[model samples]
Each structure stands twice: as C-alpha cells, then as structure tokens.
Target: MTPDLIILADTVHTLDDRPHHEPIQAVAVSGGVVAAVGSRSDAQSWRQAGTRVVDLGTATLTPGLVDCHIHPVFGLDLTVGVDLSGAGTLEEVRALLRTEAANDGEWLRGWGLNPNAFGTTPMHRHALDDVSGGKPALVRLFDGHSALANSRALDRAGVHGPEEFDQASEVVCDGDGTPTGLLLEAAAMELVQRHMPQESFAERKARLAGLLRDFARSGLTGGHIMDHSEESTALLQALEADGELPLRLRTAPWCMPGSGEAQWKDMARSIGTGGRRWSIEAIKLFVDGTVDNGTAWLYEPDTLGQSTAAFWPRPEDYTAAVRYFASRGIPTATHAIGDAGVHHVLNALESLAETVPADVLRRTVHRIEHIESVPDQLVERFKDAGVVASMQPTHCTHYSLADHSDNWSTRLGPERADRAWRCRDLRDAGVTLGIGSDWPIAPYEPLPIIADSQLRRRSGHPEQQPIAPAQALTALQALEGYTSHAAKAAGLWDVSGSITVGKRADFTAFEMDPLTTAPDEFAASSVLGTFVDGEIQFMLERLG
Candidate 1:
C-alpha cells in the first residue's frame, strides 16, 4: 500500500488527547485521510510510485485552523467596499468616504468605522453626507451591530421618523423624533439596506469562491458561519457542486422570535449534518445587541444607564425557540454579550435540559456566542449545561483596555469590566472553549488571535495595557481552542480536529511552532501552506 501524499515537517503536532505524545517527523496521507504519522524513516517505507512528497524545512504542522464563528460572504462584501478599519481619525474616514463616493456605484458602502476615532465629535447623517456628496451611503461600525447612513440613504429607505420594532433595534432620532441616520442592530440597519441594490446570484457565487480561497490563504481550513440566507445557501451549493469550495463551512440560519414552531420544524427537517465540505445544523439567535452600540441587554444599565432592552421583545418567545430546537437534537448559537443576555440564554438551555435526554443533548451541543460578561454563578453552569463558549479572542485585544479606560470599560464600570472575557476561568471550570476571529468585527487571521489569547494585549498598540492578563490562556490551550475545541463546537471533531490516523488530511503549516513561540513573535510568522484532504489549498511562493 502506498500513500497519496506525504508531508515532512520539522515538528508535527497531532494534538491527540493522549497524556504524552512524541513529535512526529512525517504524516502520510491516502485517499484524503491521514494514513500514517510516525518517524521520517517509517514514512519513507510506505512511499511508492505516484506518492507525492513535500518537505517543509524548519516548519511546524498542526491541525488545520478553524474559526468557529465568521461571516465569510458578508465580510467579503464589506471588505470589497471602502475599508475604514485603518482610519485613526475622523478626517481619515471622511477622506476615504470622499474617494468612495466619487466612484460610479449607485450606493456608497463602507465597513469597520469605529466611532472612538472621532473623539467627542458627534456622528450624524450630515457628517456622512458631507463626504458622500449627496449619494446614498451606509458605513458599518467595526462591531457590525450599528451603521451610519447618509441623509440621502435615509431618504431612499424612507426612514424619516422613529419606528417601533419587536426587538432591541433602534434608529437614532433627533429631539424632534427625526431619523438621525445611526442604525442600531440588524433590524434597524436592514431598513436602509433594503433599499440597496441586491447582487446577482452569479456575482454572489463568484465572490464567495474568491473569499474561500482568501480564507485558505489566511490559514482558515473551515469556519462556523454565523448566519445563512437564501443567497448564501445558493452560493455554497454552487461552490460544492463545482468542487470550488476550498474550506469546510457550517452555517447557522438565523432564528428570530415569533418564527413559529412550524417554521422551525420545517427547517429542522430540511437541514442535515451536511456533506464533507459544508452543512447547516445549527440555528442562530440573538438575545441582545452589541455592547458598544448601547443595545446589549444588561442587568444594570450602561454608564449612562441606557439601552436596557433585549433583542427579543418577548423574552419568553426566545426561550421557547431554544427549547424547540434543542428538543429536536439541533444545536443553537445565541449571540449574548451582556451579563443579562448571557443569563437568559443559560437559563433557557438549563431548563430545556431537564426534559431532553442525555443522548439527545449529547448529539448536538448548545453554544453561546461571545460570553462577553457573566457572573461567577453562570460561569460555573456552562460546564454542567454542556455549553460551548464560542468566543473571539480578538474582541478583547481590539476593544478592551486593562486599566478600565476603553469605552467598553467605561460602559461597564470597574467591577464588571474586571471580569471581561473570563477565558481562563471558564477553561478551569472544565468548559470546552471554541475560539474564533469573528472576522469583519476584527481581523480574520487565526495566528494573531492565538497570540493575542496568550499576551492579552492589542496586536499593534503595545503602549496600551493588557486587558485581564490573568484571563489569558497558555499557547497550547489557545491552539486547542481553534483546533480540537472548535471542531467539537461544530460537531466535526470525530473527523477533522486532531491529526489522528483515519482523520481527514487537513493541516496548516507555519514557520514556527506556535506552542513554543513568543506571543509577540507571531506577528512576524508567515503561513507556509494550508492543506485540505491531502490537497494543497494554498502555498507561499518564494520571491527569490
């Protein structure tokens, strides 16, 4: 018997569950599965005619990196528009917008706008109109929870006055109850977005294929995409049919309150565990909005004691939806950012577990997206409830400050701010952590996220203090969060997480061993290559 592909690396981390394991020299792959992992000499013995061998000198290989929560399609759309992610001041943002507005497109769109960059200066419709040149425009804040729309965009969407919503969404209003063009939450943003021209199916599919390739280049073998839509589903289906999908995609369709049991039952019946490359097996729900936009459902109000509403106007309806899905052995991921929001999700899952059988519960794991803030009692309940904390380490590195000086800290105050991202506490409590980049909200690369998890410091701003240094995880633990732990969260652990024999031949190669490299050194590291099912998805080209 001969292997189809053989990968030789200086160090191969299997990340197996065994107590002690030796570093392997080579990995043998056959028929898209890991056939053998042992000494370099042993790998040579299995080689025969037609077996492809690649030697990566001084490189370290590990399980393919998995970003448990991401929005590949949505992120790509925003990225292709004006990118305000690098703007450090309002002038910079305005300059970028001016250039974008001059383009031929009917609507001017941009993403990654952080309000803090403007200092105390207010952000209103007129500010965007000044640079937008009267063209309709919408710029999303870095959080994706809010967006700024120009006056023309507001007129186009016919959002002239305050409107009522069933969720915690808000359209900023002036003293006269006139729309101010600041859209809070998805529901509110959709008002103006509904007026934007829809992309053709062909365009959507083409962009998705391109984005998946980019994801492979960034060292992401797969991800648990947060939301699913008809267009997104069509794009994935087309890619899978053409064999163009380069990464594993697990999507969770949005499940809102008042969607009804019939709709859920039908959705549960239609969606399955998916094929080898992509699938939809989970439902995504939002218990509250983002903390930055003053929409998060908090036990106590924010610094100004404002935005104390839940995403679902009827909290009981959300609880019922969770029970309905959990009882059917389908996983549910709730975006809960504040203490009250986290508590509500936990209570629902805990109550449903009372009647749901152990085997049924074990079949699918319930997950909480962004356990931003939680009390000690709720933290202890995560393990018992069998919940997977699908968290983004970059959220901390990019948003919070250790000295409780950042906007996030100021909003929560010192007491709650100190407890931000208790990753170490949750892990010590025996909880399985699924870490991700939450792309579009932050950077999409996994290496930087893994490093930030260890250093607990912002990626580029070393001058800023680290946020909750004690909450940092060890390098090895951080790796598990992206590999083994992330795979389990997506219910693909048995087939893809570790480099165990019989698993898929998915691997990510890096210049240095992440487990031993200094956190700061991660910035200089480069991705050597990425493989999926024994096939090279991406490889660096030497410039020499």
Candidate 2:
C-alpha cells in the first residue's frame, strides 16, 4: 500500500541519534508515522493509491522546531514613536517621538528602546513634550525594567517622580527631586499603571492566540511559557479544551514575595495549565532584577564600583519559595542573570538537597535562565547539581558591543561572555542545555537561535568574540536544541522531539538542505511544510 504522505527530498536529516547525515531519497509516511526512510527505489513499494507525494528537489527536511524559552506577548509599540534601537543620536529620538506626538491623543504608549541604546545624547521629557502636541507619551526602556513618561503621564499618575512616589522599584528623578519621567524597576512601572489601565484578560488572551498562530507558522511545536499568570493559564486551558492550541506550551508559574503559603499552593493547583497542549514544568521565581536594569545579582557592584545588583526581599525569600515548592517534589526554574542571583538560587537548591538524597535531587531538575556570567567554580557546581541552563544565545550577540561601558562589559567580562550560552559545556558537564527564545523581549522566531548555534556569529555588532567558538553546534545539533533538548527540558522527551515510529508525528519539513549548507545559507532557509500528528500544518514557499 502507498503511504499517506510520500516526501522525496535531497536530504532528510531524520534527526535521530544517528541521523541521515547524507541525502534521504524519500520518506514514506503512513498513518503519520514515518513508515519508510530510505532511497527512492523502495518508496514506490510503500506508496498507495491515495498517497500524496511531495518532490522537494535538492531541499532538506527535519523534525519540527521547538523554542525552549519564550515570553508570550503580542505586537509591541516599536513603530509607534522614537525608537532608540538604531538611532545615531538623542536628537533623532526626539524627532521621531515628536513626529508621533503630532497625532491627537490623550496619552502615548511606546516600548523597545534602551536608555544607552545610542552612543550619544540621552532622551529628556522636554524633548518628548515638544513633539507631543499636548499629550503625554510613555516610552518604555528597551529592558522592561524601566521607562520614560512625559509630564502629563506623571501628573496623571499623581507623582512628580521618585521622591514623591512610595514604592520598591526605583524611579529616576532629577537632582532636584523632580520626576525626570524615567520610571525604573517594577516599583516605578506600578506608578505608570495608575495612569494607564491595561487590557482585560480576555483582550490579552485573544492577542496571545495570534502569537500562538505565528509560532505554529514558524515550525515551533513547543515552548516554555514564562511570566505566566492566572489569566494566561486559564486561556491556555480554554485553547486546549477547544483544540485550538496548535503548539505545545510548557507553563511556568511565578511566586510572589511575602505571599502566604496558602496563596502559592492554591494558585499552583488552580493554574490548570498542564495536561493538554500545555505543561506545567515547574515554579518559576526571580532571584534578582535583570542585568540591563542593573538589578542582576552580580558578585560585585557593576563596573561603576558600586553594587548596582538588586536581590529579592532577602535570601530567605528564595529559601521559603523554593522549599515550599521543592518539598512537594516539584522542579523549579529561576531567573538568575547575575552571579549573585545564580549563587543565591544555587544555595536554595543546596538547601533543598539537604532534605532530599542525591538521587532525588537529580529528579528535581532545576533551570537557570540567562546565565550571562557564572564564575568558573559555579560552572562545575551546575554540572554536579544536575541543573539545566535554560539560556538565550542572542543576548550575548546584541549586548557584547565593544563601545559598551566598562560596567556592562565587566559584568560578564570577555572571558565569561565568550562562553555565555555554554550549550556544549552544559552537555559535557552532565547538565542539560535547553535553548529558548524569550519572546516579546526576544522575538519568538527560532532562526536567530539556529543561526547563532550553527555559525557562532552574532547577527550584528561583530567586534565581540564568539563564546565557546569550538563549542558551536552543527545544524543538526542546533535543530536538536529546538527539538529533543527542548522536549527533554519540558519532561516530554519520550513523546515528541523525534520523527521515530512511536513519537507523535509533529515534524517540520524545510525546503532546503540545512544540514548540507553552510550556516549563512541555512540562516536564509525557510520552512516548506509542517505536520503535527498526521495532519498538514503550515507551508511556506522557500527561496531558490
């Protein structure tokens, strides 16, 4: 009998343990299981009258891609106003926002620009208002840690600035205590929120659906959903029940500080995120602020010779949080970009280890996100502790600019940055390397992750050296990071990640020979068709 789908491509990297390193003449799919993977000569035997044969001339096919790390958010306001992303000077920032100010509006909202994004000229409120036609505009800092608001927004929020505001997140004020419109940290954003009401959960959920569709089109079959909230979990459940969730989602819930044990336990159970297209892998906690915001828990203060690092309420916060979830035998994934943060989270795990045996410790797999700079000793500790370094490769590519200040440079240092996303090192040390695209912060697209892993080259700003250049993975290895490695992290290693007989047929077929081509060519490659569980999904036309 002929197979249901007979795809003949020049090369099909079965992506198995010993993948088809050479070209695959044809792949026979029957009942969505790869019935035959061999030369074209035997394909005819497997083909049935109803089989659909796709001739992928000289192209390649592999398992569907998976993003291990990604934040779920809809379209940003990058195009709305003064985007300092590529602006050469602060005047350009003013000119752009000023232009947007021309539109009549009660308030302006924009995000995705760094304070130091440009080498020269910092943005100020005066410049912001000059362009605002009597409306206040809020421009969030590239890093979500901070943002800038005009006088109108500040007035609406009912605070002049940091001095007048009573909160934890730092609000940047002028030397005279006048609000400079710069809202720093989580504390400050709360003030901005007083003025701007966010979308209802239903609105956000609909937007999230759009994002999931985009993910499916990109060949992403699974991902670890961070920054998860109750509303988000409910929506995921709704999608799964409705059978509208095309991509697999692994949901991670965050624990709030000073919150009661009852609160945590209740949310954990009621989350109802797992069991369908979504998986509740662990409890996600933040040990410190992000590096961009000078909140990362570094070993020392920033290069400025001051301890700019910020920690949770206290080590006890993590201790209580981790142990609360840990005692229940649940795995935890913490946000630890700074060494201090990593050390603190590690200490929490060490505390948990005391209660559980070595064997049990391995079962309670922990993950550290965005380890920009871990000490030499910590690297070995990570291996011994059986932790998973859930890191992003693109951060180093963008942050490692030679022109950056000594503080930002020294935080990770050249040595550590050189091995930022130590994918190979983690694997060698017996630690799992789970790669992810932190969407909203980093686009959900996996091509950048694929490009960086295979080529070991930054997309732009090339002065920085490639970390663990020799540790660079091959195209197949990179593909595995998005597939098998990711599946292993989500505790779904046995179900998906491969195109084997028993595994679900959630595979993406590319239209080019990614395994045979160089990194550059693969970077430009596109997806041709996607199949998840015996059904055709997305099909993108490939460039010749």
Candidate 3:
C-alpha cells in the first residue's frame, strides 16, 4: 500500500481511551487525513517505498494542542509594534522609548508591556510622554483591558486628554483633575486604534505567514481565532487564497444584527472560508470588561469595592442580540468574566433558552470567555445552560501578573480570588471549560499554564499569595484543558484534538512526558515539532 506520510511516534497520548491509555505508537496519514493507528508492524503495512516515514526518536506525540481563546490579531499587532514586555521599570520604558525612537519613528508600536505583568507599580503616562518627547507612542496596559498613550498619541488621535470624555471614559486624573496621560477602559485607546494604519492584504498575508511559523514554535497547531475586523477577515481570505494558513483556524467574526436572521446569515456567508481552510462558526461579543478592569458583571455586588458592572449593553438589549444569532443558527461566544457577568449572561441565555429548543441550545455551545470569577449558584446554572466556560490557564496563572500591587486581589477579595479561574471546580460542576493562552497577553505556550495550575506560583511572587492555590488543576487535567477538551469546545472534535484514527494527522512532538514530569520539569520540556495535516510546520528537531 502506498501511503503519504507515516509518523512512528515514540509515544502517543491517545486521549480518547479510558484507563486513560498511556504511550501508544505509530500513526499513518494520507490525503491529509489520519489513516490508521496500531502497533509498529500494523502501521508498517501502509509503509510502501514512497511513504515518508518519521520515527521520532523518543519524543511524545499527541494531537496538536488547541488553544481556543487566542487572538490571531494580537500576534499580528505584536509583530508590528513597540514592545514594552522586557521593560521592568519606568526607566527601562523610557530607555526603550528613547532607543526605539532614536532608531525608528513609525507609530511607536509595542505590546506585552504590562508594567503590572512585572509585578510593579503602574507606570505613569508622564513617563511615556517624557520618553517619546514628540512621537505618538501607545503602551498596552499589561492586561489588555486598557492602554497608556503619550501626550502626542493622545493629540494625534484627537482626544487631547481623557477629561474631555469623563461621562464614559475613566481617565486617570491628577489631584488637579487634569487629564493624566493614562486612559482607562475604552476611552483613551479607541481613537488611537481607530487611526492605526490598516494592514494591506499583502502585509497581512506576510504577517500570517510569519504567524504560522510562530505557532509551530509554541506547540500551537490549532486555535480559535477572534479576528473580527475587516482587515482581519481580508487577511484570512488572502491566506486561504494563497494557501498560506497551516493551522486549524476557527474564526469567530464580529456581526451586528438586531433580529432578522437573514442579516446575520448573509454577513456570516459573506466572509466565506472559501474552502474551509478556516471556519467562521461563531459570532463574538464582549459582555463585560476583564476581571481586573472592574467591569465584569456581578450579582452579589462587588465585595472588592470596585464596580461590579456588566460588560454588555442592557441585558435585555444584548439578550435580543444573542437570540438573533441563535435564531440564525450561529453559535455565540461571549466574553463574560464576573459572577454578575455570569448572571447577566445566564439570565439572557435562559430567556433565550425558553424560546430555543433543548438540542439547539446544546448545539449552540454558547461559551463564556474568561469566567474569571464565579459564585456557587452560577456554576450549576452554567452546566445546565450548556455554556462552555472558555478559560485561559495563563489567565489563571498570569492574572495577577497584570496587577502592579495587590489591588486586584484586594478588589476580588481572597475568597473570590480562590474561585477565580477555577478549572477543577468547573470540570466537576460539568461546565465545559475550554482552555487557551490569550496570548501576547501571555505567551502562547501551555507549559506556563501547566506550571501555574500545578505549582500556583507567580513570577516574583514568592511572597505574594497566588490567586487560589487550592483551585489548581493536576498535570493531566491541565494537559486535557489545552488538548482534547479544548478542541471539543472550539467545535473541532471531529478533526484534531486527539490522535484518533481517520482524524487529521496534526500533532505536536514533545521531549518529556508531561504527565509524568515534575511540575517544574514542564519548563524544561520543549516542542520538537508541530505538524499540521501530517506536514511539519515549525520544528526544532527534524520530524524523523
């Protein structure tokens, strides 16, 4: 028999098997689909002379890790921006600004510069203003919930200052009530983002080409992309046309509809995947700001003393919006982070559930992103509602990284913090928790997440308490969070989550047994290769 590709993995984590099944070996692929799986001899039967066989030494192989909550656009933004991730203090930020400004002057692009991510005090906008001097520089607050713009950027964006829009904006004001350069929430940042140059289709194609390579290095061959912008949609079209995309891209394009099912249907249809190189299965919406932003909807009234604001329009208003998509047969993925946010969404979902059929509710797979904080009451409601709790483990571990001081914990209170990003509890409560990286916000790697879930230790926080050490998940559980279960939540169960026969031969090759490795050992383990449809995309070691 002539086969296309044969990979004799040293070990395979066949996640579908109960007893959970350890170390199976050898998989064959043909026509870009997984052909068979069995003993070495059985797999060898398909190994004709032309079959390109890869006997990957002793590396463990499994279905490609699927990150269900990443922003493909963030990766693109990072490639073109001023990066403050390496700067730890105001001085470093200034020097970075100074050096980057001296060398280049094109819209000071930067990302991952969360001063809070370094566990320090938030940098004042004046520090940024002083450095860039006259250039338009924008620094994304570590959390991605807000950003700090220099005086020039504020001017270029035509806002001058946040004081101009206090009704909706939360501009950091000095004692004098003068607009400090810091812009909170959507107030100060929207203008700059609006004015930021759009990536041409060619530039976007090249950016995605590079991003595909970046995906391979990080062990991510499958991701659910929240790329809803027009430029973003066009980029996917270009990649599909050029045949440049090499990962499982499940797109959730943004759609605005009042009620007519035809409107959403036509809109979703307009952004065609062309030939399914990608899938635009769901519609994306944000019901509240992130937990740290003090905007996640809450029911018990924020015990942390911060505002327990719901991140959506009027519940009834968005309820209709959610139902509009539901009626159109499109799955809806919402970003709801707080308990009130949960309740806000639950009430909306239940109201819609009464009109929508049970099986349709099941098929809709409406997911709540972040779900950063959940009260006991909403957990059961979430399970019964059939809502998928789309979580990012890095969000669990790196959450406090976004806080400069202990403000977030103080805001969340210790008890609620314990319940923050509760993976094990959600699983126990029967909530479908799909794990992700929320990358560039955090690295697009799973090891740190595994470390966080198991170790519960934050960088530079040997003294600071972790949000919830008790809520930690085990290694196998964390792995599953990033693998099969994640794939299931992203609506990719039929394709790539586990190494089942007849699925795509997409997978990752690893150096150590993540299941057996010591918690810290996860940091040492590396991705030898990342494969998509049996073709190696990015690899540190050769496939064979």
lDDT of 3 by residue, 1-544 (tens): 4569888766778776544333468888888777877667777677887798878778888788878877777567654566776666666766777777775555775666654443445446677776675778887765676777777776677764345442224666667665566665664567677877767767767877776667768788878876556676677777777764667777786543233456566655744353455667788877667555555666655554655655444456567778877765667788777777778877887777677776766666678787877877888887777778887766665546323244455567776666767777888887667777777677777666666766666533456455566677777777887788787786667776788877877888788877787767765578888788888777774543
lDDT (10s digit) by residue, model 2, range 1-544: 4578877777666656756645467877776566667778767787777888777676666777778777674232222344455543566776667666666566776666655544434445665766667786788765566777888877878877454322236666778888777666666767766666466767666777777878887777667876666566677777667565777677777775556688778756744446556767677777776666566777766653433444556568668878777666677788887777788777778778677666656556678877767766777888666677787766655455433342346555565445455666666677767777676555556766677775566643245556457667767667777877777776666766766655766777675665666666656667776666656656665521
Runs in model 3 lying further than 4 Å from the true structure: 18-23, 78-80, 115-124, 160-177, 186-188, 195-201, 255-266, 270-274, 300-305, 401-405, 458-467, 542-544
Name the better of 2 and 3 by TM-score.
3
- On the 0 to 100 scale, the lDDT of residue 53 in model 3 is 81
TM-score, prediction 1: 0.96
How many Å off is the CA of 530 in candidate 2?
A: 2.4
Candidate 1 root-mean-square deviation in Å: 1.9
Candidate 3 lDDT (Cα, 0 to 1): 0.69
TM-score of each: 0.96, 0.86, 0.88
Which lDDT tens digits does candidate 1 get at residues 60-84?
9999999989998777656657999
Question: lDDT scores for all predictions?
Answer: 0.86, 0.66, 0.69
On TM-score, the leading prediction is 1
